[model samples]
Each structure stands twice: as C-alpha cells, then as structure tokens.
Target: MANVNTAPSWHAPHAGFIRVLVGLFTVAALVVIAMTLAYPGPDPHTIVLVSAGISLVALNIVAFTLPWGRLPRRHTFWLALAQLVITILLAGTLYQTNNAIPLLALIPVLWIAFQLDWPHTIAIIVALGLGCIAFWLIVEPMPSRPRVIVAISVFYFVVASLAILTQANADALRRSRAIAEEAWRSQQDALASAESNAAVMRAIAHGVDAAVFFASQDRSSTFANQRAQELGRRMGVSAQDPTWAGHEVYGPDRVTPIPPEDQLLPRALQGEYATESLQWVGEPGAQHAVSVSSLPAVTEAGEQVGAVIVAHDITNLVEALHAAESFSATVAHELRTPLTSIVGYLDLLETDDLDETGREFLRRAQQGVTSLSAKLRELLEPFEVAGASPTFSFIDVVDLLRRRVNHWRESAGTRGIVIEGPDGSSRLQVPLDRELAERMVDAVLSNAVKFSASGGRIEVAVDTHENSARITVTDHGLGMTREETRHAFERFYRAPTAIRRALPGFGLGLATALSIAQAHGGTIRLESAAGAGTTAIVEISLTQVGVAARGSS
Candidate 1:
C-alpha cells in the first residue's frame, strides 16, 4: 500500500523551488541593505528599487510555500492556502507602490490559473484586479498615471485571457493523452487475459482424460485442441462441429448423447455461459460423473461475445464422499443402541435397593455409561454442526458459568479439587448462544477441575472491556508439554501425561470449546507450562447489542 512517506526521495524536483526562494530572499535582502547604506536618504527611485526587490523575494517565498512540484496532496492544499494570502498581499503592495511593477502581479495570477482548476483561478484573478484598481484610486500616482493605469489594466486583462486559453488547451491535451493511454492499457490487459485463459484451458484439457473447447461470437470455434477432437470421435460426436452440439458421442463403452441439460454449445451460440457436473447414461447401467464449467466471454465494453466450457470426469471423488458419509452414519447408529441399553441398566441399578458394595458397583457402572455417552456425542457432534443454524442472542454469561461450575463442582470435589470464580464485583454479560456457550465453558472448566491435583485451584475470571470480553480459566496442576499443548485442541488427541495419570476424558473438550467460541465470533487460547499451571482464555467481541446486553446482564 502506498502511504504518505515521512521522508521522500531527496532528489525530488519541488525542493528546487524552495531553494530558489531562499536564495532569492537572501540575495535581495543583502542588496537592499547595501543600497540603503549607499544612498542614506529617501530617494523615490532607490526606494522603488528596494521595494521591487523585496516584492520579488516575497513572490518567490509564496511560490515556495505552494504545492508547486511533488509535495503530498494534503500538505499541498494547506500550504497552498497560506501561499494564496501572501500572494494577494504582495500583489496589492506592488500595484499601489509602483504602477510599472503592477505587471508582476500577473505572474501569480497565471501561476494560480495553471496549477488549480477554473473556479479558484477566476476568483484569484477577480480579487487581485479589483484590489489593484481600488489601491490605485487611493494612492496619488506620478505624472503618467492614466497611461500607466491603462497599460497595467490591459496587461492584466490580456494575460488573464491568455492564461484561461492556455489552461483549457493543456487540460484538453492531458485528457486526450489519458484516454489514449487507458485504451492502450485495456488492449494489453485484454490480450494478457486471453492468453492466460487459453493456457488455463489447455492445461485443464491436458490434465483430464477429457476434451474442452471455447467458441467465439461469429459462431466459429475459437479454441479446440487435438484431445477435444479425439474425445469427440470416441464420444460419437462429429469433429466437424468443433463446438459440440447435442449430437450422439460414442465412447469406448457405448453410444451417448450429450445430456439435454449440458447443451453448452447451443447456449454459447446464444452468448450465454452454461455449466454442468452431470453423469451421462450410456449402456443399461453405465454412467460417469463429469465436472463441467462454463463462462461467458465479454469484451472491455461489457459486450457478451461468446462462452467457454471445460468438462472433467470426477466420478471417483463423488463416489468416495458418498461412501464416507454412509459409513459414518451407519457406525454412529450402530453404537447408539448398545449405549442406550447400558445407560438405562445403570440408571435402574443405581436407583434400586442396594448395599454399600452394590451402590459402589452401580456408581462405577454409571460412570462408564457417562463416558460412553460423551464419546458417542463427540462422534455425532460434527454431523450436527453441518446442519446447525447460526443463531445468536443475549445470554447471562456469569449466571450460566455459575450453574455449570456448580454442576461440575460436586464431581471435582470428589477428587479433592477446588474451583474459583469471579467475585460479585465483576461484570459477566456477553452476547452468545445459551446452550452452545454454556456447553463450551462447561467443557473447558470441567477439564481444568479434572486435571488439577487434589486440593489444587481452578480459577475462572470474566473480564469485560469497551470492545470485548474475556473469560479465563486457570488450573494449577499437571500441565502439558509444548507438543501436547500444540495439538491439545485436536479431537481425540489425549496427551500421554493425561492418559497415563488415569484421567478419564475423550479429549474432545478443547475441540468442542473451540468450535463454539468460533461460532460466536470468539476464540479460545491457552497458556501453560509442564508443572506451572494452565490458563485458558476465551475472548469474544462486544460489538453487537445482543452481546453487550447479555454480557451486562
């Protein structure tokens, strides 16, 4: 990106004007001082000479301050305004002091006209001329006042007229050059685009074991390679019609007509692009999936010229995706039945009359059921995400967090773990989904409480700011190594330490939490060391009103 550089190339030409101004003023001041010392009295001619030199120096200074050559645009406008006031003052003084030097005022007038557009040029000219006439009336002139006045007035009028003409001609020339350059560039761009497109089409045709062709506005084939013609013959298409019509094409297997849906050649002739990823039925049970793309060819003026279509066979990819989805659905369904029965029996056993040993056995059975249910849910969750609608609403994040913490506190307490949270002073409102956000927070905090050693603390803090909200959960217990932390959020990726420590978790907590955070336009990040502790931070924006209300609530 091109920004206003603080320091530009030192060799820039605009500095020349400033240097000239400085030199002019320095030389003029020295000469005026020397001459004043030489004369030592009030002589009109000498005074006029000194005044003229001073005015010349001021003119140069005004020019220097203007956006004369290569200054940045913003600074140019500001400096130009300052220069304008100085120019008006100097011009008025020169006109009043000596009629002969009034012609010098025309220089600034012409300069203004050339540099800026018409409105400002006209305004400056009018102001300078009116001010000079008014000053002439006020100041008593020399013996040749009428002639001098007439001469100066004519000079200004003639110069102003010539300046306007010159400006118009220069503008016209610039516009003509710009238009010509734009046309030339467009031609070059179009040629490059055409060459690129041809190369891409050729490469695509070569990569696939199929043919591709493009047609032009004149109903003539613009591009068709040897492979396309060969494919035409194999598909029983007449090679004569270079842009394939809906004619029968004989492949190695059998005779096949281009499907009614894929009449790309006909559409191209009518100046419309067509696309199809279709399977052509050949023999009784023969079909092959072919991916086809079509695009309308247009000119620089946006005139539709023709169309190009490329077809590539992708039957294998389509089949593989279908098979995968089917297998996943079947596996998930099969596991659900056995899981339901086991959970149901555990529920019954836990509720029935039982002794101490029986109660302990039932509790273990229920824990197993809970773990199985979680694994089953994890396996099925991704499929639901595909169809899940993105819905957002205001939610009491603190209240929700509290409920989840309370629910998990009992389980963590059994292992002698402590969970800490925000005090009553902290704000805990955020915009998010109730169920998804709750589940996500629950998963992360649960893992924190689970992994922490007996009596170790799991701290939860909710920090709100003007633009965002942060939820941090820190656990002081067995922390992960670098490699483990890197892949900690990956599904089913249990760390060696975590697995060896007899912690019962499916390792989907981080992954699910990450998904939920992302859904709410938030992120979950972790900071941890091997033995130090782990901190999980969830940052979500408070840009939306719903989010703000929820967070505030």
Candidate 2:
C-alpha cells in the first residue's frame, strides 16, 4: 500500500496546547467517575474535587479556544499563561491530597512551549516544578516518597519540553511557506497582466496603416507587418529574401549600404538611439517618400534587447506640400503681371511725349495693361468652377469648334495666322459642358494664333473616336520640348522657347483647358517637339452630357 501524507487542518500555533489541555482534563474526569463507581469511597465527594479540578482545566481550554482567529501575540501569551496557571493549580491540589499526577502538572508547560516562545516555555516549566516540590513537601502522605515524585516530575518536564519545541518549529516553517507562496502568486499575476497589456499595444500598433518592424538582438527582422511588407516592396527589400536589414526604408533603392556605425538596428542594439526622415530614389524609376522612426527595447536593468521601427508613408503629404509651393509661385507670377502694367503706365505718363520713341513706349504700356487684365481673368476662372459644378450638355463638336474658331477669326486675321477648322465637314455630337468645351477649343486656337509666327497656318480638326469625340488644334509654329510637354498641364508653366519669343502671357490656358476636360470625365493630351509643330487634343464622353441630371432624380 502506498503511504498517504495527511496533516491537521485549521491548526493554530496554540492548537496543540488546547488539545493537550482537553485530553488531560478528560482523563481526570474519567478517573474521578471510575473511582466513584468502583471504589465507593467513604467521602465520595472526594471524586467531586477531582471533577472540579477537571472542570477548571476545561474552563482554561475554553478560554484558549475563545482567542483563536484573533490577535496572535496577546492571544498566544494569555492562552499559554492561563493554561499554565490552571494546570499547576489542579495538579498541585491533587498532589497535596496524595493523588498528584506529574503528567497533569506538565500539561501547561508543554502548552506554553508550543504556543509561545522558548523563554515562556522555560518559565512555565520552572513554575510547574516548583508546584510539584510544594505538593510533595506539604501534602504527600509519606516523606520518603518525595524523591519519586520529584523524579517523575523531572521526566514529565523533559518529554513535554521536546514536544512543544518541535511543534513550535513546525508552525514557524508553515507560516514562512505561506508568505512565500503568496508572494510567488502575486508575481505570477503581475507577469500575466504585463503580457496582456503588451499584446493589446502590439495589436493596436500593427492595425495602423503604417509599417511596423521588430528586430532581434542580432538585427534580423523578427516581425514584419503588412504595411512593413508593402514598404519593403517599394524599397526593394524583402523579408523572405536575405539582404542588409538596416537598408529597409521607404524611399528609393540605395545604391550603397548605410554605414554600420550609423545603422538604426546596430545603434539600438548598442544602447544608442537614432531616427530621421529621408528621401530616397528606388530602382530605376521609383520615387517614394517616407518618414522612419526607431527605438530600442530595453530590459529592466536598462540593457538593450531589440529594436522597433515604424515607417509612415508621406507621399501624399509631400505632394500637398509641393502643390502649396507651386501655388505660391503661381500667385507671385500672377501678381507680377499687374505690377508690371502699373509700373509701365506710370513710366509712360511721366515721360516727355510727342516723339515716335515715346509713342512706341506708350503702345507697349497699353499692351502690358491688356496682358495683366487677361492674366487676372484666367486666375479667377478656376474659383468660378469651385462654387458651380460643371453642367454637361450635348452639342455638335464641329459646330462648337467652328463657332469658337469664328469668334477668334478676326483676331487671327489681324495676326496673319489662318484659323481654318472643321472644314464645313461631318458633324459629330460630343458630351461636354457647352461653355467650358467652347472655351477649351477657343483657348487652344488662341494659343496657336498667339504663338505662331506671322502668316502661320492653324488647323482645327473635330473627329469621332472609338467611344468619344475629339477636337484637335494643330499649329505650324515654334514647338515645345519633351519636358515642356510633360509639364504643359501645370499652371503658370510656360515653355522656355515660347517664353523667349512671345509677349507677356501667363501659361494658364492649356492648364485650364485640361482641367475642363477632366471635370467632364475626359482628358487632354499634348504632342510637340522642339522645331516641330504642336497638336493639342481634347476628348470628352457622350454620357457626361446628361449623367448629372439622371443622378439628381
């Protein structure tokens, strides 16, 4: 059979004392009852004395029990002291009557040893010994029997002392273990809470639309989230493919690796910190903008463990910043025109007149004023569309182009630039904002006339394509370079060649034409080369004519 280990439940430090007291009293009571029944003494009331002594001992045990689960220091002290006093009294009384039991006298001493400290135990033992000596001297029937009583008392004290000391030591150990177990459980709970909070923080961080990376002590990427993977793709870095880990960034591909001394992971591992925003060019044709931040994960002792990197995409932010800068430049360019006109008019009016040179200067001043007025009108056109959405209406492309061409025909005639268009040919209906579409065609034709040399030929071609109508304005004049064609749609972007030869004209006509085409879900494209002719093509959809009205109802 396997051995089973068991222990007493709910044992106070003084429980052993209480049990011993109860047992001694019960023994005394049973002895008294037995004597009453079997011996039938002359004064059977003698058994009553024994019973009373037992009752007193029982009372002491009850007192000890009353204090349990209460304050330990006072309860233990009082319990041990009362038990000692009651045991000594009862045992001394019985001994004086020639019925002294050394075992009974030893009860309080053993209890004191178990419940209280060693000094109290020793005091209890001394008191019990003194009471035993007094019992022998005053109440023992035979003087010669004193030695035997004393010897028995000494033996009882020794046995009780050992038992109490052992019990006290065991209780102390149990208390210590209880404290340790409580501390350990508290630590475990703390660890679990910390881990839970960390998980929640990590989840929230990764859920954001920014790249997140965690690198190990060795600087290898341990965790790369979705955003991180996407950024890596743009930067020509891959989690699956081995490469220089520190090179993972948002911008263009780096032709050379970052210096080891300046690397984020290495510095983080070395207990240093670094983070900054950088612009880089990716492989061949990559242009990505990013802001990167890195920090070190440190231990409790402040030792660096790992590193975390967060990369945020700032491409849109970069573009918006650029747009604001461009707008500022355009505003300056627009203001220059009006300021130039005022300056020229002031100069011509102040100068002495009545000569050919002065007359020519006056003519130039008038032209400058006219150019400034036109520039202000173009600058205000975009804001007009801001409050009013485009209204698309069906109109014949040939008629529209011809009407706008004829409107500018007298101006073209004076400039010796022939504005021949539509050739009175086939009609093609196109979806467009009627006013905006005509203005777009007029702007292109006007530019063709303005830029063309005297006697230059300008052609307006209106035709139908796969799913849309196209308006083409071709001019045999000074052409634009490839770079100019690319930026032709930018407001205030005048071609270098055109700016060198033309009068004062803000480069907003083509940009406005392109914006109108886009508002109608259409497009405008330019084809031109230096020394070669230029063509401006505008295309609009048929559905754009009535889609807004259909959606409104």
Candidate 3:
C-alpha cells in the first residue's frame, strides 16, 4: 500500500550556486549601464532600460539575504523560477538594441537545471527555447536569426542536462553515507552487549561462595570456578582435568567408593536431578560435610544441552548438631541423678509414721519428682534412638491404648477430667515398637490432661482402615488459634494461650509425637480453633505389619 522507492522532497540547489547567480546578475547589470552611457541612447528609453536592469540586480541581492538553504523545496523552486523570468525579460530588452545580451539567458537556464529535477528542468528549458525564437523574430530584426536561435537552445539544453546528472550523484552519495552510519551504530550496540554479558559471568565465577561446575553435552569439556577447584582438591580429584566424568567419588564412610552412575554429575548428564550430602575425611582426620546438587541445563528451545553442578560445605552445621545431641544427653543424665534421689527420699518418708497433712505433702513431692523424671526421659528419646532401627512386634491395638489411657486416668481424675475410649474391644493387631508406640500415646494424652479444664472430657478413639490404623484424641479445653495449630508440632513452640496460662511444658510433646509417627511411615493431623476444642489424628500404615506376619509364618 505504500511506495517503497519514494524520493526525499527536500533536495534543492546548494547555497553556493545561489551566491554565484547573485554575483553574475550584479556584473551583468553594471555592463548594461556602462554600454548605455557610452552609446548615448535616447534619454527616456535609456533611463527606462537602465532602471529595469538595476532593479533585477537589486532583487538578486535581496534573494541572497534570504535563508535559501533552509527553505522548503516547493518555495525554493518558485524563487528560482521568479529569478529566471526576470533574467529573460532583461535579456529580451537588451537584445532589441542589437547587443550580445542573449547570452545572459544562460544564467536563468543554469539556475533552473541546478535547482529542479529532470521533469521541471526540461519543461523550463523548452519554454526558454521558445522565448529565444520569439525574441529573434519579433523583438530583434537581426540577420542570421535562425542560427542565433539554434545556438542559444543547444547551449541551454547541454548545461541543464549536466546539472541534472550532478544533482542526482550528490543525492546518491548522501544516502549511502546515512546507511553506512546506521550499520556502524548497530555493530557497536552488539559489541557492547557481548562485553556486558562476559563481565557478569566473570563476576559470578569469582563472587559466589558455592562451588560451581559446568560440563559440555558430551562431557568432553568442563569448567570449574575457584570454589569448585578447592572442593575437588580436598576430595583428591584432579580439578584441572578436562574429562572427569567417570572419576571415583567417596561416600560418607570415606572408605567405599560410590558408583560413577550414582554421582551427581553423571546422574545430571543422564537428565536426572540429584541433591545429597556426603561426609569426607581429610588428611588431618577432619570431617567435612559437602552438599552437592546437579541439574540438567536447558536452552531457550527446551533442549538439554549440558549440566550444572553446585557444591556447598556444611561442616559447621553438622558439627553443631552433633554437639547439641551430646549436650542434651549430658544434661538428661545430670538431672536424672538428683531426681532419683528425691524420689527415693520421698519413698522413705512415706514408710515412716507421720501426720496426715505431712503424708499428703510427701505424696505430692513424690508425684512431682516422678513426673519430672518421665519428661526428662521423653525429651532424650530422639537422641537416644538415633541410628537405631525399630524392633517390630505384633501388639494388640486396643489393649495398648487401654493400658496407656488407664495410666493417665488417675491424673485426669484429680482435676475431674474424664477420658473416654472406644466402646468395644477387638483384637486389632499392629506391628510396631511397643515402647515407642506407648511413648507416642503418652505424649498425646499428657497434652489433653494438661490443657483440659476441670470437669472437661477427653475422648480417645481407634479404628482400622484398609491398610492402616487411625488414632484420634479430642479434648474440650482452652483451644488454639488456627495459626497456633499450624505450628503446634514445631520444636520449642508454645501457643500464646498456653504461655499466658503458665502451663507446665517444654513444648516437645507434639514434636516428639510427630517424629515417632513419621518413623513408622505415618502422619499426624491437628484441627483446632480458638475457644473451640482441639483434635489430633495420627494415621500409621499396616503394610509393614502384614509383611512382618508373613515373615514370621
């Protein structure tokens, strides 16, 4: 719909050509005045002719003062045409005197050729040729009229043709220069973008703390950042090797070599993602824990072109966990010794004769000491069971729940808190660690009794589903907000209400319960709202129980 080859409209004669035309007009006017004065023509006729020549010169001078170079193309064309008409009239008047004034027509013809394109210049040239013939026949009665007309027309045509060619060449040269400049600018932009990308890559290689490694698709070439090189050296790997795909990697034991296929880099190259922590022993017997992650590198087209591996040192975290476990064991042992002594003293005082009030105080002291000892043992169970596999045994689900519930009945009764269990008893056998299962139930029941108000009721229910057992404990007490329930199982987290009520707890009950449930491939769900009640449901899979039964058979 648009013309693609349209020419620019602003092309016009250069300012130098306009100045030359003005100078030529001034010289022609002076020559006319001098010739008239020397020839001594009729006074009135000479005055009229001299005044007309001088006025044409004055007009040319004024045109020079105008900003011709900045004028629009159409306006500039009309200005050149006006000057040409004036030149024609002056030349016709002088030629009537039989002088060589016809040559002055060349000025207007040249100006038109330089200022206009081929179409406009040719039209003006034809008009000037007609004017030359008319002047020769009508305004002047000179001999050899046809020869004069032919000479003037031939000269103007030649000059106009030359000017058209020159203007076209200049326009083409300018257009070529503009295109070259645009190409140069694009090249500069591309080069700058490449430099910026390289700088960012270099900064990341040196600035990041994590070890970074990159490998080509075929594993023939590899790149390792500074941190990665250090990690490789510590692991006895050749950091500078180009082909390290099949290199041996050590496991946590530091003695057995891990399979090449199982290593992070190899797995990643196979389009698999991997993240794991491995322990290594250095020359000085220092333990180092390194976490490695590997992922396939994908391009914009979604093609897996290579892989990236990142490794991080976690030695401090591992050491801290070990130290914390040791501290917990030491504290539990130190506290148990004094608590056992207090319980023994209370037992001895009970046997001796004393007043009823004193005996009641002794009983309360014994109960407090016993409860403290139990909690201390429960708190240490996680550390104690670390790395120890559970010993599975078939146990009656109903009987286990009944025995644990009865153990808490006395304590609940003290506050008029009633605990209700399932109505009927059935032999629902489940394979689990008996002691661990009892401990899990104890945590749930303890929280129920501790939070229940006087005369409140705690309900316990057990049911067997397809391949699992579900245990639900509901308590009508000062419940928790939704936000508090979300974090109820987090270690050391106590609800705001529990803290305000000054409840005696270490905030470890629910967390310990969750750990125990997860060990048996189970999950625990809590439901509660402020001012309502709280319900805890624990689900444990029975697939392992069935497997154990078949193995025994």
Candidate 4:
C-alpha cells in the first residue's frame, strides 16, 4: 500500500518586520564601529567598543537568518531574552566609555514587543528601565548630556508600545481569516448535498412509468419529466395544470364529472392524500390512475407547503383485462354445447351396455366427460371472480395421485411408454379437495405421457412429512430449453420444440395444475434442460386453513 500523508504542512513565519530590524541594526552597528575606530579616546577603549559593535552586527545577522517568529512560544521568548541581554550588555559597556549608545537598547525592546506576550514584554520593559537607572547612577553622564539619556529612553518606550499594538491587530486578523475559511467549507458541503439530492430525484423521475410533477406553494409547476410532458400533450394541455382545455374529468363510470373538492391535486393542496382512477374526455379519450401525496416543505419546524402529483397510465392493463374476460365468456359458450352433448350420449350408453368390459368402458368414458366439463367450469370461473377460493376436503392425496396415474397408464402403454408409481401403501392423508387433487395429478401425468417418446419411462413418487406432502414426476422425454422451462406454466405457452413436433396440447394443463397447487397453499417447481429430460415437484402444505369442507365420498 502507498503511504498517505496526513500531517499539515508547516507554515513559515512573516519575516518582513524582522528583516527591516536586522537591516537597520546592521547599518547602525557598522557606522558606530567605523566612528569608534577613526577617533580613539584618551582611555583608548577602541578595541572594546569595536568588539561590542561587531557582536551586535553578528547577533542581528543570526536573527535575520533564523525564523525566530515561527519557533515555539517559549523558545521565541528565550531567544528574545538573549538578544535583550546582549544588547543591554553592549550598551552598558558603551556607556561606561561615555560613547552615548543608549539607542541600541530600543532594538531589544522592539524584538520583545513583537515576539513575546504582554506579561513578558512588560517584565522585560521593567528590567530595561532598571538597567537604565543603574547606567544613570554608575556611569553618571555629564550635566550637559543628561537630556540625551532621557530622550533615548523615552523613544525606546514609545516604539515598544507601538509594536504591542501591531501584534494585537495581527492576532485579530488571523482569527477572522480562520472563521471565513470554515464558512466557505460549510457552503461547499451544502452545495454538494443539494446536487446529490437533485441527481437522485432526476433518476427517479426518468426511470419510472409514472408521470411526476414538482410544484411550488403557489401551485405553479417547477419541473416535469419526459413522461409527464408527453402526458400533458396527449391531454391537450400543459402538465402543470390539473385540468386543461375545459375538458371534463370523470370517475370510473366516465359519465359524471368528479367533484372539484375530491379532485386529486386540489385535495393534496389541502393537506390530504388522494388517489383515483379518472377518464379524460376529449376527441380521443384517455385514462389515468392518479395519486397525489403532499409533504410540507418546511424548515426544522413543521409547516405546510405545496404537493407532488404522480399520474400513472393504466389504460393498456385495463383493456387487456376486459379482453381476457370476453375471451373466457366466448370459450365457455362455444365448448358448453358440445361437451354437454358428449356427456349426455355417454350417460345413455352406460344404460344400454351389454358385456362387463363394454360396461366398464362406458363408465370410464362418462367419467372422462364429467371431468372435462368440471375443468371448463373451473377455468371460466376465474374471469368472473379473480380470487375465488377453492372448495376443500379431507382425502388421501397420495391415493388420488395413484388413481390418476393408473388412469393415464393404459393410454401411455399404447405408445410403449411405462408409468411407474411409488411402491407399497401410496396413501398420505391431507386436507384437500379430492377432485381438484385428482385434476392436478392428471394434468401433470398427461403432460409426461404426451412428451415422452416410445419406450420412455415416467417415474412418479409421493413422500409424506409432518407438515406437508410432496409429489414428484420425472420423465425421460424430449426436454425443454431454459427459456421454455421458465415460461412453461404460463397460460397458453408451449415450448418451441413441442410446437415444432406438433404435440397435441392446448398448453393449459401445467398452468391449471400450477394454479390448483397454489390455491391449496402449495407450489410446483419444474426443472429441465434441453435433451436431458424433466423433473416436476409439487408440494402442498397440510396445515392450510379452509380445509374443513365435506369429506371426499
């Protein structure tokens, strides 16, 4: 892993003031040294005075090179103290020779004022004052030059005071800058959050089929997605408006206009949630399932604001439902007559049968006709009541499967297909309608027999547990592809291979079988791969309610 740097970069200190002080001191020290060297006094203190001047020059040079202001507070204080002591010692030596170098004391005072806090600066000032007093007593200047000493001391005090004021102003500016930077960062974060929220809203608006509108508190629209815009054009008005072109908006009946108070947008503005299916009457009629939900656009405290309106076009779904209902009715009307006639003829033949075998054949034919009529009725019933519940009974589900498998065996044997069932006592008690269970088993068995090739084997098994019973059917047949198996239970869906082979089926057997299993709180799973055969498993929960109907006869 690459190393990450987390530490803040070091900031160099401001050196403008320190540089000016160093330059001034250097010039003053050189001039003083030249004057002392040119004019030696009677005591001839030339070497001592020149040495002090050279030391002052060297000290200022060090001060100019180092970043004294950037050092720690205590280190800076000690450095300033060293400069002050050196300056005091040099000036005291000059005064001992009567060289009149009191102005040098001002340098240390200025350094202290700029670098140290108020308390330390004040302490240094007092110490410098005492040193001046000692100079006045010990080096007692001549009566004519007393004014010079007083004037120089007063000048040093004034310069130190000015430095303190400058430091105070600098501190204030630094604080102000820090606050401004914090506010700028906060504003940037807020802008980023707003942009993220806008992106999410845009994605939601464009991704769904629903038409969305964002409006202000004054009921003016601020935004509408592509779908909403299209919907508005279709309705012959702008999407911003709840109604357009004086067009009447009617309820589900499409006759009477809905009350204005009950309208979706109007109710939402009143802080009420509203949803309704409405029809727009125009040259070409349109239908919408509209919902309006309001959320107050408030600050931290609660307040009411405008609402968001979502309109969905469910016209295609509604039309498809109507078409399916019509088709079911037509199928029932067409099949009823023929099926009734067949059942009547079979019933009559049962009475006129002569031999035992003939009688048995007639009985089987009548039963088959009866089962077909019942299936037709069950299929048509759903078009009227979509979720109508099934009638149930207490019966042995395993026995029901065995009987249906046996019925299909003779037909399958004719094509050289073998039907195998579970060995020994195929009796598992469960609460389910005997006729419906039989129908489900017969449907699955029929599909297996139809799809299996000659000499193929169809294996059937039933296993019972404490909570549920399972029936499995495995067939070695012309299997289905992945896509075919996925849609195998869809109504009227036949596998491509089956269609190509011209298999005899209406494609409703597995669909009806799946429906029956689900209605009894069960599920059917089909697994198959191309050219690898198929396995069908049906599981029914035995503890489902509404199983208290009459027992199977």
In order, the Cα lDDT scores of the candidates are 0.65, 0.66, 0.73, 0.69
Can you tell me which runs of candidate 4 are displaced by over 4 Å?
1-322, 338-389, 478-486, 495-507, 545-553
Task: For candidate 2, write residues 1-553 as lDDT tens digits.
Answer: 1112222234464555555566666666557545445645465445655665566656655764664545564355555555555555444445544455545545555555555666666666666566656545544556457576766567656756675675578569768767766766666666677777878877987799888877778765377788877776766654454333434332333344455455454455565666764544245345566777789877899987788877777777767856864684578577866677786766668556558887787778778777765666666655444345776555677888788888888988887878887876677756566887776776687678877878889888877777666788899888888898898877767888776776556777887787777777779998887777799988776565457535543
Task: Indicate whether candidate 2 or candidate 3 has the larger TM-score.
Answer: 3
Worst 10 contiguous positions by lDDT, candidate 1: 1-10
Q: Tell me the TM-score of model 2.
A: 0.39
**Candidate 3 residues 1-553, lDDT tens each?**
2232343433444676677877787787777777777776654657756776777778778877888678654455555565566556556666657546756666666566655566666766776666666555544566655666676667666655665665576557667756766665666666667677767886897789888888879877677889887777675555354434434456776566666566666677677887665645344355467788888878889998889888888788667756866777789888988888888878888865788999899878888887888778866876655444666778887889888888999989999999997655576778877877887899899988888899999999899877789999999898888899988986667888889999988787888788888777687888887877889998888886557545654
Off by over 4 Å in 2: 1-45, 53-61, 64-67, 71-73, 76-82, 85-101, 104-107, 117-123, 138-142, 149-153, 156-274, 277-290, 300-302, 321-553
In terms of TM-score, the best-performing candidate is 3
Q: Please give the lDDT score for candidate 1.
A: 0.65
Worst 10 residues of 2 by lDDT: 1-10
What TM-score, computed on C-alpha atoms, does each candidate reach? 0.39, 0.39, 0.53, 0.46
* Cα-lDDT of candidate 2: 0.66
The 10 consecutive residues of candidate 4 with the worst lDDT sum are 1-10
Task: Evaluate residue 269 in candidate 1 and report its C-alpha lDDT on the 0 to 100 scale.
Answer: 66
Alpha-carbon RMSD, candidate 2:
22.7
